[model samples]
Target: MVNNTDLTICLFPKALSIPSGFVTLGICIGNVFVIVSVYSIRSLRKPCYIILASMALVDVLTGIFGFVAGLLFALHGRFFYFGDTVGWLLHKVMVSTIALSLLHHLLLAGDRYFAIMYPYMYIIKVHNRSVMLTLIATWTIVILGLIVILSPYYSKDVQNVLEYTFMILVSTQMYAFHLRIYCKAKKTAGQVSSSTCQAVQNNRSDFKAARITSIILGAFSICILPSLIHSIVIETQGECGRCRLPFYVCSMLAYANSMLNPIVYGISNKTFSDSYKKIFQKIFQKIIRLC
Candidate 1:
């Protein structure tokens, strides 16, 4: 007779496990490059790239947590291989890191918004120290908030409600901020004086940064929304037999987001892309010397 564990194992086929392993690896490797490029390149040591580096750090943690969970799932063919408590802890950590990533996106959007809309203020107020403080504050708030929401004091339903509400609010604010930035850029395009070539150049650079961030935001939204909706459906309707496949799909999509940001950065930002090329060239040279 087939046991329940066997059935569970069957549900999580090797097909899913194999791809998940690859995706987790991709997330870790891609984000590591982002962090290294940002750190090694002196030009990237600015407030904007600083925020991106922090985001990459958070994504690396997210990838680590996902890898651990996926390893257990792959080994046991079931989740929470270490038991429910450990599993829930891992889940909370994953959730928190993802929340941090989203918050970082929000920060990036706000950073660009201020840079373009209130350039004088941004120049005066936004610096490495200020950006670091904002990042620290963001981390503290999200960690504390997650601890509260995921605490045993709240029932599962309450936890779900709170999480959903937080995600929605943050996402909405990000959208609004990016929209304003878009409008501001459009309105100011013709107003910049051709006489001040430096001013025009600066304006163009700011807009380019804004455009890259917008693309990142769009990729994040597209990747995460399906997972968000899936969670809502699972909570309200409960998981049916058919839910298993969609659950895997949604999860992979969510995990894919961590890997997408670095790709977007490489493709959209010339500085980052150039750094990537140089890094690869150096790595190749090292391998050749070793041989």
Candidate 2:
């Protein structure tokens, strides 16, 4: 009567402990930094910024609470023991974090669609309450999804698989948007310096955000999907083999979402970029004076 925890024993042999430790640390520290950066901005008080901040916070938790710390349990095997409530909470938080991220992404896509398609007209229409509603709704959606999975009818593994699948599909919508942006940028290449083109890549356009979303969704579909499938199969069959590698890879890709938002995506528009540069320049000058 072996179970999922026993599966960890199976993975311990194949996983590169050294690399996993470093990777997990990298994700935890990097995501923590991004979340902190997002909140430090008084200008980032809008709904969209809140959503991004939440996502980064969860990414940090998922990396530390879900992966890096969870791995310690695996490394210790039967040597480590913890209270039942703590263990339950850990699993619950992990599930919630992953599901919530999916919901936040959907909201982000919706936000972009409105901003680009409507622009000035939309700004006048969206009041503060509307933003609050969107933020509340994102968590509501995640909670509802978790309630479905946490139901007595389904197993934990079932919930995990469904979460991964939902992420894959919803993310595809975002990727399609990014692809459209890429095409538009290509068409206007001569006029766009590489830096200028980069800035507009995810600015406020109907095509802008959707296109950037496409890039991310596309990456998840290709790089993250196979691993998710592997995970589902292993869970359903109660068998373990070469599955851990893909599962680990997919998890990392998902966690990388936080870093991607600030780096890979074109959220750094001219306005934001200029702001970023000015702040950094002042810091650099201060540093030189101190030296």
Reference-based lDDT, each prediction: 0.82, 0.56
lDDT of 2 by residue, 104-127 (tens): 666666666566545566677765
Off by over 4 Å in 1: 1-11, 80-83, 191-196
Task: Estimate the overall C-alpha local distance difference test score of candidate 1.
Answer: 0.82
**Candidate 2 CA-lDDT value:** 0.56
lDDT of 1 by residue, 176-252 (tens): 99999888877877766443688677878888889999999999988999999988887777546323878878878
Model 2 lDDT-worst window of ten: 77-86
